[model samples]
Target: MLISMKNRLIATLAILAVLGLATGLIFPGKHAKAETGKAVSPGSRMEAPAKLEDTAGLTAFVDGMMEEYMNRLQIPGAVISVVKDSRIILAKGYGSSNLEQALPVDPATSMFRIASTTKLFTWTAVMQLVEQGRIDLDTDINTYLKSVKIPATYPEPVTMRHLMTHTAGFEEGGVGYQITTDPAELPGSISETLNKHMLARIRPPGVMSSYSNYGATLAGMIVEDVSGIPYNDYIQKYIFDPLDMKYSTVVEPLPKSFIPYQVVGYNSETGSFIPGTPTFEGGFRPAGSATVSAVDMAHFMIAHLQNGKYGEQQLLKPATAERMHSTAFQFDKRLPGVALGFAEKRVNGVTLISHGGSDPMFNTEFYLAPAKQLGIFLSYNGGQGSEAASNLLQAFFNRYYPAPEVEQPEFAASAESVQKYAGSYQFTRHNSSDIDKFFNFFAQLNVSIAGNKLSLGSGSEQQLYREISPNLFQLEGGTDQIGFRTDESGKVTHMLLDMAPDMPLERTPLLDQSKFWLIVVGVLAVLFIAALLGPILFNRRFKAMTLAEKRAVRLSAGTAGWALLSFITLFMVVMSMDTMQKFTSISPLLSLSLGMPILLAGLTLALLVSTIQVWRNKYWTAIRRVHYTLVTLSAVVLMIFFYHWNLLGWQFG
Candidate 1:
């Protein structure tokens, strides 16, 4: 939710800047190439449309669309590959790789970081062990670990199945400082990183899916332990070497041989492409941080679509590959289900077994239709590139396989029940026991009931979901569904959206989503400004202040002033850093920086007592006393908001 909110804020602020409204708003890997399956060489351009056949027409149409979108979005480069019937239908690159040199992208060799898509390879490695009868998907993961043990938080031990489906119940980890520019800063072993950065399991295994990077890395380590080889080398020998994916690798700090093919990612700021640091995910490499070319990725897609066969080599038995695509968990029986490491998404009635990978600058989307023998992969090099990738995929699917005509099911939900479901929901994939829990203040889902429609957020931006059945709603006029779970009392406790039933959002109580807190922030902002100009606005009145009244005024203004400054300082510092570097870089200044909030919280107590003394005095007017009292009350709520979110504490935990 914080990520989505940040992206929306970025778009909003960028648009507002065009209209000159910029002043306000707290907004906020290397790998080697494959030696086999060569199709097009580096610097090869797209072939001109030949006679406009269905394939040729598609090439022309998509090429025009990609070029237009890339220019409009300021993306540095893009690569798209399509495989159908064990053949590469299209593998083309657009735009420039080196913006400085004007080097056009090479569909055959230009490498882009395929973030979390690396999980697919890791999952494949685990399945390979399963085929050899060396690892059990349902067995306790701790049984396989020799280096570190997960804390026994639940009777139900986490299994490889749970880890693959992202239902191991681990909270989200590796925020702020996980990614770095220096390879020397990373841990020597994947196990060492996993042990040091292990996340707390907040729920029993197989109960909820929080999309954990830690769980994925743990699975990779299991492969290492079971195979008696390092994780990266294991992937190379088993998966990469078998598939002849010579240009792809799971290694980090990228091998020197593949360095020439690397495409630099651009950060979109100041309406220009600024070259950003090459991010190394330290210990979190298994979850993401793999680089591969479009043509090599196409070979991967072909193997998966061809029942685990690439030419003569069979990576897995047809049955095993099918098992990998089987539904492991579904949010609702009616919605798409998660298939092992792949997430299930439906587009135009076509089931797309897919996974997307994204880093600070690069984004990747890959989808395969097993039945259709169709696969498409896209990678973009720019900050907002994911947005374009989404648009391109939607347009491609809608143009190709249109949705079938299915009659809409009619049902009515009682207003009482709808009202029960209407409330703010806090995402379960959050830091529950750490200071990161403070992110909840901005990362909340607001559900509103409008007639029979359930709208998310408020006003014009709300996405209305129509009630299709009791506790089941479909995004209005769209196929995706949201399911609400209720207790025996019929009070909604959780909502499952899309395929991720394991990461259902829990309802937030009124206190947690208090509107009064927003009011306090607004009132405090006014008081902060007033304090700066109060004496000038009423100089005569200030001159007549009694010693006690003056002291009271000073205390009230001091607390309010301190709170505002601390907040501004934190926001500015955080917003300025690269998103990945924001959290971890604050360590050097944390102790001193955290003192301001602690002081403000302490001053909140003093300000409250002084407000009481002001009421007892007779020198001040009734209006003055009331104004000061409200300001003091606002300050009290401000401190509580900071304290409740664990912001007042200096510890990151």
Candidate 2:
């Protein structure tokens, strides 16, 4: 009648877990207060944790890691420095600034594309000006930049804090300055640009953290107007010169200031290294495009380490420096939290403040360990800066705080609950594999009750499904109600899923799993039909042409048309979600359902190319051979990718 000690403990644990689950449902938004470095505020003195552990070893690890990553990331070079206690514990450069000529990178002097790291500098300058009683953090920035105006979406005025923390409601529209896009299309001058784009609110100021390149650029505009100097000139006079950072420059400011060791920035698409574009031509674009060397980066970190002072000159109050490091983006707790222009994460009670930068040809990251007086600056030519930075950080974490292994608990699924999950689900596909990527992509469906919990199905992913009533079960892993609807007699029918709480299959299912390939084949047929029709409609002389000549005409017309369509197809695919990023990323289904037209377009062209060359080519053997060969190759490549992507399936399709 009595339970054993071990069983009692297990039962107690299970009961506690049930109690916890019930409590969680009742009090949903209760998260314990976060731990920061023990009440770190402005004016409160910090007891520095200066326990040094193999500073040189840490340097070698970071440098070696950066150099290795640079080789793969197509980055020209990177400079890294980690300092503690106002001392340079580690500073070095990896890879030549100019990879082609093999010019050496100097840790102390060689320059790099600092990217968004310049925000810290701009913020420092703003804070310095504030301490001197010129600008106010919470005041309307329009007071200084007379030309710039925030859209009157809000009942009251927008403040400088909006621009600083990216709560300014400035829709990015797209990447700040795309390589393919013209700079003319960018926010002309900082003021005009802000006036043109700054809306009152995507969410209320300080309500949600949406990143804004416009906001930071506006700050630069304010710095220029408030200081009565250009943004570049102001930073040079206040931030750079004071810190004695000679190598730091924004955009093309140092166009003529050449260092033989410098590497040109690259265009990501062309895969060829292009020279760096100036971040700001005029007005104020401050969020990105600051070039500096590792040595200069070290100096900047040292200034932060010294609580906003460089050598004898106290640039900002210690309070402001602390403010800059604190959390800035607090919109949704579930999403990654951010600090002003920086990302914040709490690991085992210690808060980590970090930011990553990616330009066309460069990438960079600067991590601050304020308590240890330690900071790491990882800069690279390509986008591998995040990789190197994350790797080094993870390695350090592994070394200092090795996680202890605990026993894995067994999880048993309810068979009756899982039984209801046995039917097919149909929805439009999404562009992103991630649930929220690009908003509503395509419709997705899952049938669970299989032995394996997860598998890579077709071109995308498969989720674990549990049965609820043989045709209705809650999606166990996510926050959605997905059911396999049934016919009157309880027979399985199509799937019904709510991608969004209120979306009505916002993405309607165009291709069921069984018929998706047929649909693709139909697309190819469309191309063929269109190709045939074009010639019949346009080329009057085709009727008079000889058999061989007629064949050549048909192949040529189809090939040319399809080839152009293929190009357009590729372009549209990028715009869908695969490439042309949904800047707002509001709905994932946009690309999945909407992209059907583009996909159908591509398939139609492909079919035209295929059908015309194989069967319709009018016996011009030579033209037919070449045309058919290219068509076959294109089809093979397209199908291979499609099949790989799960868009085309063998057994399932």
Candidate 3:
């Protein structure tokens, strides 16, 4: 009645997925529709207007919508700016910037961390250099770098074009120094950070898009090398000054004059505001370190919308700007894919170029519709801002440009055949090395199929997807879709999650995340507890046994117990906050934690010896033999787990 580690692992994941589904944790279904008229206390200052207007009604409508979502999602503050027909339609802020200080968000002047949207500016800078023949998009990136060299893994070198399109094929980087709320822990210079964190190039350059922050930062480094100016200074002098973006800067350790205008980001999990700490994203400053107000971002948007012209301040040539927005890479020919630094998103038949930014305490989104001459910029100050950002963007597209009527294409399929496609899928955009690889287990997704329709997660949070093509499915009543790739034998190997479509996600063999290892740990716990009770409840039976038998029994149970204990200690340390940063800190606590897995491995060997002795002597009944074999197998699995996580030795760093 013992289980195999493989099956147990699968069962454990399946069970966890079920539990997650029951609790609405993982794949939560659709969110609740917004209620504009919801009543709230006067102190919150969120009230909908009594009547809607036809002329300039968007201002009041957006106000009510933002307030409704903020209250419902527990978001403290948000700023939204929309530019339509080359004129500012609305630029407004709603709710409190700091709940404790009771400071209101100011769209005109209050600066919020714009995160990875800074990549757009970085790309713009690269494009500026390209226009002047200062940098070549097709040239190897190493040609301009002075401090670091990308380890050339593939025959074709990484080029500026690949970086701009997010197709540089660099493995996803940024673990320890990406973003933090503490200034004291700021990573060293940009070049140093990039040099230390050069991730392995898993895929060949220009093969597929991976949305690499490292790639963008390297581009910035190239800018610094070519211009003979600091990355921040180059941006301020060329892009910011020309566009009159007086309030925006990528400068790390932000200046004192801008301190008063910077808004404090909130942490929804702890229900507190993060103090105005100067956290630098190190080399990623080029990728996601820009801070700007909605008003200033609007000006930046205006420049892009105007095709590199902001009243004689030409940041880029008109043709160069056009090329920047044009499609640089296409994953699925039918779907809008990467467009240089921008991502092409089609909603309701209109293609909108956009990019989004996120930090621990902020969520920002920027989108521009050239044909419509529309630009939308919004930023929020808390974790809940994630949901708010998505909802706001969806609502805007739905209201302004509704999809045209079209006949739905029928996909022929049998329910039974389609059901085989349902399982847990793991994202490919994951850390390939280091302790982070172990964290991938947590990203397992549970998928379910009904007829030809696919639903992610379970219950109210599940989003419905229907097949638009044989292996490609689209969200029902939505434009986003994911395509499944099949192997030679017609087995599905990967499903592209359109959000980061380039990140490969293969179906997990385990149906759900029941975590079979945990089950083994639980069994060991029971065995240890039973052994402890033997002296009290069955002392007479122990007295009847020979010394050798007693020793064998003690050793078998002891090893299992030690393995479980050591594992728990190691798990706790690995999962600790800032574990990545702490990995290199050889502090006593971490050293002891790192050593636990070695102890577990030693215990595994002792258990194996006991099992071999039991087999040779034929010591007990068939039931006992089976139990010992299972326990031995479980111990082996634990040893493998430790090895898999690189914990068998002190290889954490």
Candidate 4:
């Protein structure tokens, strides 16, 4: 089989598909855990320390934790700030900011891209206007927009509240222009970008949350329209200035004075740090483009913890700040939900209002425990920074506010009852109408049964979950809760996790599951191989065929050849690129590869006509005719797969 090029290629593709499926089956991706320590019973609580009386002890713990994380995760640079009772307990830096120069990160002056953490400031600016009666949270967003109009796809208009809670129902947008290394790529203003690339509304407003970067940027534009100033200028004037955060700025392309302090973002490969180009968020700046130092971020956190008062300067009224921290949207009463712009979660038996940020090169985590009057912020410049930040925060909570061990509800649902919820689910925060939709193939969450309990992940990372109540499951050894939503027929429609309030997992249809497609690909490869091999293996019989029969055979073989070849090409192209390249811009090679599916769709139609001609005229033996029909049907299935994954044509702008 390896002697022929066609056979070798077919075998390779089959092996790749098998490996991909096996990987997904045996090691499903890890889900965020609710608590990092022992489980806490319902209605129970564990209080965090009231004050940082042992600052030196806390410093030693942090220093040891950061050093271990940096070495283990290969993070070159990071900064962290912690505040308790409106006082900075620790604001420090670790590792090197510039590897080549050996320049250390400065907590007070060194700057790092805080990414979507910038959205908090943008939301703060909006709430400040709301406090002054300049804006209303419930009004339709279109009323204040001087430019760009959100289409009325649904009866309910998207409001500021919906945007803040990520329930505006807009499909994912801002691809190809959200982040860029070139300054010339940016539009003149936020309105120009929004108007040119307004996203399609996929769901009804204020229904469900799906983290939308476009929604946040639109809210920033509304701030500009209502306040009569640019979004960045408004933040600098209202939030930054009031908080006295001198080392922070939302302005793209840092000023000359701030340039020397900016840390170099890095990607570690084979024990070497490779510096990445400094990225700009362009018109999406309001969503995640601000740069700030650890000390400056401490000021912003302290203000929010102290009810919007940092010294004499009050960025938001006490009542408005309280409202911002309160729960504004929740899918289920038992699970964590969204609080205005903040994501609410119960970790270590205490409620935390937090927001996380990530760009290509930087990752950040920000959390505020208003009840404890404590806040923590950390950002690192490395490829694995997101994982590092998550681990650090989990360790911090487990050390200082560990949950008390308690009995958890046992598995009460029968195997039949649990079977109804077992399937693949796709996250709601994905592109549904573009080439970017192809990436969703790898983002599915698989649910299965583990003996008597429900398993909530894929692969080796599966976590056992028990049904504490109907449709609500809790992690066996942790506090994480996963709630399922059912339709009128009691069929599960969506799954909500306590750790990720900004997105929900919608149950995927049987035909649309990734495993289903993988099986189809494997079967199609076999049929296509047979179709191509039949001519060569039976050349003597082929010579005796009539003109019509020969024509039919040639058409079927050609169609199968194109299907196999084009699919392999598409696979190779996608596997070669990373997530950032796929989302940021479409290269020429990818554009051409996407066009191949459209050509294959045409060939499949031609092959279908040939199959009908073979049957009507009796071009071959019944068994051969049946095999040819199977090959033709396989071609049709391939076309359906292409269309379902948004690969039939060029869908990018």
- How close is every model to the real structure, measured as TM-score? 0.84, 0.58, 0.84, 0.91
Candidate 1 deviant stretches above 4 angstroms = 1-54, 414-417, 457-462, 499-503, 511-516, 523-553, 575-578, 587-592, 605-636
C-alpha positional error of residue 527 in candidate 1 after TM-score superposition, expressed in Å:
6.7
Instruction: Give lDDT: candidate 3, residue 62.
Output: 79
Tell me the spans in candidate 4 whose CA falls farther than 4 Å from its real position.
Answer: 1-51, 458-460
Better of 2 and 3 by TM-score: 3
lDDT of 4 by residue, 163-226 (tens): 9998999877444555777767753478887887778899998889888878889999999999
Where model 3 places Cα greater than 4 Å from the true spot, the runs are 1-55, 99-101, 185-187, 269-278, 416-420, 502-504, 509-539, 546-548, 570-591, 613-626, 649-653
**Model 2 agreement with the true structure over 406-460: per-residue lDDT tens digits:** 3223345555544543533422112222212112222243344555232113222
Q: Count of backbone clashes for each model?
A: 7, 40, 18, 5
Relative to the true structure, candidate 2 reaches a TM of: 0.58
Worst 10 residues of 3 by lDDT: 20-29
Global Cα lDDT for candidate 4? 0.78
The best candidate by lDDT is 4
Worst 10 residues of 4 by lDDT: 20-29
For lDDT, candidate 3 versus 4, the one ahead is: 4
* Candidate that beats the other on TM-score, 2 or 4, i.e. the better one: 4
lDDT of 1: 0.71
Per residue, candidate 1 scores C-alpha lDDT tens digits across 284-305 of 6777768999998998898888
The C-alpha local distance difference test score for the whole of candidate 3 amounts to 0.68
Candidate 1 vs. true structure, TM-score: 0.84
Instruction: Judging by TM-score against the true structure, name the best candidate.
Output: 4
